[model samples]
Target: SVVTEMTGLGAHTLRGYERAGLLQPARTAGGMRLYSPRDVAIVRRAAALAAEGINVTGIRRILQLEAEVALIRAEFDGVPQPVVAASAERGASGTG
Candidate 1:
């Protein structure tokens, strides 16, 4: 599958990802998995995070926060940019 090619993960690993709640691919009438672009991105990111020594639980937390940040950024994209940089700096400094 395209996802396997994109992420270097096998079919078994992909199914494990689905079971882990890291991927939400669509299903065909015959129960075939069809991965969307977002699923592909998540798989790639998960693989990268795993390669970087992050365990599955930590990767889940990071991915969840990243999605939340994207949503917040999109919501604020039309308005004048806020002072989120300071907030991000604080987060990086472990003071948030």
Candidate 2:
């Protein structure tokens, strides 16, 4: 998981993700940050954006949209042409 991969980050960094409205990883019965693949991807993307001059707030919004777009793209890809067009229109209308 990303938490295990990121061995040096302290508690504050974990808290920061939560504060930014990022995924709150499911806790174990004993209380641990059980990150999902999606959560890890978000962290990696946030890091990449930060490296490219995006501030935390901007990164947060971008990450949110990236996840949404990914899901919509996945659904669109699974559907037929008419459905795909409808999905694209929904996205264009900012309703997706």
Q: How do the residues 31-74 of candidate 2 rate in per-residue lDDT, one tens digit apiece?
A: 87787777776776776776799888898889878779989999
TM for candidate 1 is 0.77
* lDDT, candidates in the order shown: 0.86, 0.76
List the candidates' TM-scores in order: 0.77, 0.64
Give residue 70's error in model 2 in angstroms.
Answer: 1.9
- lDDT score of model 1? 0.86
- Score residue 31 of candidate 2 by CA lDDT: 84
lDDT of 1 by residue, 2-91 (tens): 778888899988897788888789999999999888888898899899889998888889999999999988987756445667767889
Using lDDT as the measure, the top candidate is 1
Question: How large is the C-alpha RMSD of every model relative to the true structure?
Answer: 5.3, 5.7
Clashes of 2: 0
